[model samples]
Target: MTKSAAPSTEYPGLFSPHQEPLPGALDGELLYSWCARFHRLSGNSKASTTSQMLFGHATTGLRHDFPGQLGYFGAATGGHLGTLQEIVQARTQFALHALFLDESTRRATESVFQGNDRSQLSRTLGLSRSGQVSLTPLKACPACIGEDRGTVLTGWWRMDHQWPSMYACLKHRCLLNVMANQGRAHWLQEWYLPVELREDQWAEHTEMGQSQVERLIHIARWTEALLHQRDIYFDATLLRHVYLYQAKARGWMTWDGALRFATLRAAFADSHRGLEALPGWEFIKEVGSVNGGFLGLLLRKHPGRRHPLKHVLLMAFLYEEPLDFYAQYENSKLILETEGPAALDRRLTDMQSRLIEMVESEGKSANASCLELGIPTTQGLRLLTRKNVAVHRRPRILTDALKAELEALLRAGTERDEIARRLKLRKAYVKDYLATQPELRNAWEQAAKVQLAARYRAHFLRVLEDNPDVPIKRIRRIGGNGFEWLYRNDREWLAENLPGIWRRPET
Candidate 1:
């Protein structure tokens, strides 16, 4: 509604008191987040109206947050805000900026990062729109919005959702809902509010395959990782090179180095089985053809920049990590292969890498690594004979001792939560571990009976013992309930334990 507001006549002349940006807001922030904060602090409504006085021209969209235009926001805010490099490193999704190979894109990005001249551009690097791929709806998580407002006092858009393969919130883990379907440029027409998202009207869940929720959790985490760290960056060309090389190693390529689509299809079908219904996943069918949908086009020299999520998924399927992919990509040309020494050397190198991966990468200890790798033993001496890898031999003595003590306690009728506390272990872990032990399992099965019988019997015995003069009838009356169960189930024990009970029970 505020879109038509003209700064020349309708609005205040200039932003007074040039406000400061939020504190500790470096890296991993969205452009829209700062803009919303900007308008709020400036005491204005529509940025389209207010920004004219600041940036010299009212602008919308990418002008607000991309690295090139960040200086304007800093200049208007009248504070010692960090440079555009810091802004891109911290705010805009510039970590993944290396994925675009177009030298023009690289140059434009460099222009912004260098903070040279703050010039506007027609296209954003790695930002997909109106080619093979369309822009995804702007995403907002209701839970995240509430969190940002309650803690930080604002609910701005996130760069995480803008990346490919991102469908859920990193914080809340619920699927993110999209904003208005029209141009996002309209978002700045008025003050943006968290309530504007209105997630109550959105879909409950996205289309997911079996165990996809768990899979998505890992993917979402990696997406954020990709956003923050500069450790992984490869354009489409290098990615294709990596994919084909890995595929070749796995026997998914022909003698002529062309992809054996049949092998790839079967393999992809097995791994990404239920995921075929996803947007890009649908393109897998075209692998054999020249124009192999998104997946096929990815292998081609220029497929017009597939989303980062696509690369992430492909990497997830093939490589241990981006580092591994990068290693192979860097090695393909240098490493000579044959059926002899070179091949054996590469094979050993690969095995050594795998060994390191089992221990360090997977964060598994020696025994665990040996067990997982199907090695005979985790002892360093034995492992040295097989492969040169250090196994973090976690001492099992403490764990064994804890288990033994917990089992003994469980068998003695201690409650699970109490046992966990006394042992400084988790209640769920105690329960699960207890279930694994024969003694504890048997004890758990009898816990109810033991609990009920012990409660009644202990009180009965205690009362009788404390007052030696007290009679069984008096104790039964004091016991209140469960006297019938004792009278019914343990008639013989009751007689033997309390001989006096037999003498006076007729009453």
Candidate 2:
């Protein structure tokens, strides 16, 4: 239950001849929330009256995130709520969204917020397709309501609590309580506060595991940190460099700037596990390959406005802290400023050439070459491919020593294709050799089938282990080729190892 505050009785008309005192905004309170509070206190029968008086139009301040026409509101209030820029930075999510935008878009968005013809604000910032207040229910923190009661007279909606990325409150560390109504117009005409809502008006809280709760808190904190950073803005190109740099450190990208997307997806899936519970993060649940989803759009060389929340989510996953991400960005900016991108490209080309030399000339395995050069095996392989050097295929003709090695690997239960790769023989060559040696083929097939079944079984079980709550049917789609292989070859083992199918209860 929310604590209640008595409406003020002094100063009758808010915008009339009497000129009643307007309510001051609470710290971190939303601009729409401040106006709603005023409407309630002013005893205005129509919401339009308060809207017209404050923002010179009925719908100007209706949008919660980017309430346009701040100039009118600032003038109407006689500059009581501080400057227009001050109110926008302090009350709205402008600063948070600006952090991920380029300088031109950031300025355009800021201008829209302060200008008269401001209908293009959301589209300018790429928030027209967002899953924010328009799509979700109004959210309030129960713990925050109780805390706000002590500081202010009534419980008000918090700007940070309303973020699409924020499933939990940063200070409370608990899930936000959502209003029952999910419509965008839930508060359009009404002037009400969180304290005035009935018990039945709130939605049932979604239960989450302790780990999920902690993950939500971590993301919420990062969002709030970005929200408060009014002056900082990131360039899209610099951000891409920062991400690529970090990816290299984690062996998710090559020295020549080619991304090992499969490796990256697997690692990102692990890092981003359980974060899809928050709204707008549904895309993260289904990991996409290269050039697919938000990950692809963000890494690409473009001037598009990727959502700030997504940027923060990636930042949180890549770096230990926001400061660490900022430090990396600063490093990239410094490199670009001093050395320039051409020098960086040259340095990468030199590194790739060195890696090729180590693998092709020195006869070192790609993995061994990478380890010696302090890089990842994937990087070495990609670098070798970039140089058109096929170290594995150089000795194509099956020599006596190569045949012996391939046969030894086959007898040890290695898959034929893998044997082909390891010995630099073509896959077709391995297949043709198996066709002639019938008895050797039978033994190798039996051993390889068993090995493959076990390997895929482990992979399928690991997917289940990572996402225990996902339905088995959905798991089959996302669990990779292993699920299909297991279902076809070893149904009995898969059935025994897999958890029971998940189903929703009937209403």
Candidate 3:
């Protein structure tokens, strides 16, 4: 039988507030690209119509780096794109700047994006204060566009190409093409894709020395990696320590934190002097003369201002890659915390000896030893487990009735903290107890998934009911978390309940 389509009446009316038919994100696709695709597919006549449907404003999608109203977008699409956290980490440039922001500022950025502050995000990230507004045009890779033509309708904007100082395409190892003569509003306010650009609008690529080209490419690759990495975070103090560690190793600074500024400055300037010709790269020419410059500001005891592009340039100059620098930063942290590697080794030895003496020589129980040492029982037990020493003690009694009750609670989807509170038990103790009961753990896990699936299913249906203008093709897109969860854990139910594309109800 031929497949039936959703009814014409069920189609979302023109300029519907609900944004449906949003595409699944392509690899490394920018949030801007995702929205642009929505505008094209929705057949909306004006850019503001798509923006209003997706972001509740005409200009929200215009901001590339810190796209506000993310919470609304997540809710509007019923979260099929991703949760707010997923959207922020995977689609936005937040991580690129997050490496340099303090913890509080980072948290604030999260709040702004995930909530309805509607404030200018650049100011919050200190971009305005640092005079770091991005003036460069949108960038694209010729090779990427060629490859994209085979799969997608148009080449989407990439997250990595939007970096302010990125001049090379990391994946293609070639110079990126700029959208020549197109004002910011032309691209940001319109649904212009890479494939839509006319031949004359394409700018000629600038020539650079091979060494300069390599340096720019190195910085571009580093920026790309930073954009995708979710786990790395560095603040002022940690960044300073890591920079000093490298400086000390290279004899560019004294062991006591004093830098030979003249020696370092000359070398840094020379390392990047050839890059001055590249558009937006003129900053390198004044590296030696810019007041206090980046070297002094970055390495100072307290840095007042930070620009992410400069940090990328400096980090690229210092380390082979971001992950390698992270490893060195970890070592620097250890040295800072323990005074030195020798001291760190001695401290570890002492800790091991104390754990041994408390558990073995002193004849103390694991709980007792850990309590006396002011450490967690889990830690103490781990040490004893490695030594093949059983922790002998009076076990906290788990009666049959209590065990049944605990299992029931777990299966009921009670949160761990709430369960602990009602049962008059410590949260960690309950956690450890759960770890020992695999059968019960498995049952609880299954129950949790079932409960979550039911919840998401209800939410997904409710969203559809509230936004009847949404088309059936768009229905799956708006299911967000509910759609994602049900799709993964209960595919049969999802397939069964998902409305027929051609079966929309009459109004």
Best candidate according to TM-score: 2
What's the lDDT for residue 317 in model 2?
69
TM-score, cand. 2: 0.64
Please provide, for model 1 over 421-490, each residue's C-alpha lDDT reduced to its tens digit, 9 standing for 90 to 100: 5664445566677667776578775874677677767755665676565555454444223344466566
TM-score for each model: 0.52, 0.64, 0.60
**For model 1, what is the alpha-carbon lDDT of residue 198?**
59
Candidate number of the best lDDT: 2
Instruction: Encode model 3's per-residue lDDT on 287-341: one tens digit a residue.
Output: 6774547777887767655777777777788776465677776776777676854
Better candidate by lDDT, 2 or 3: 2
What's the residue-level lDDT of 66 in candidate 3? 63
Estimate the lDDT of model 2. 0.68
Model 1 / residue 192 / CA error / Å:
3.0
| Position 421, candidate 2: lDDT | 60
Error of 2 at 235 (Å): 0.7
> In candidate 2, what are the lDDT values of residues 1-507, reduced to their tens digit?
101111222213446423656787776788888888887787778888887777667876766667766766766676667876678777887777767776787767766776545437767877666443243456799987887777666679887787767778755678988777645555555655687778988877666778778777777767755654656778777787788777777667665667787777777777666666555567785566455467777776673666776787777667655656767777777888899976544433356767788777887766545555545455567767888876563444667987898888877789765775666455557778889999888889889889878887887677778876766645644514356456658988866755363341211
How far out, in Å, is residue 467 in model 1? 66
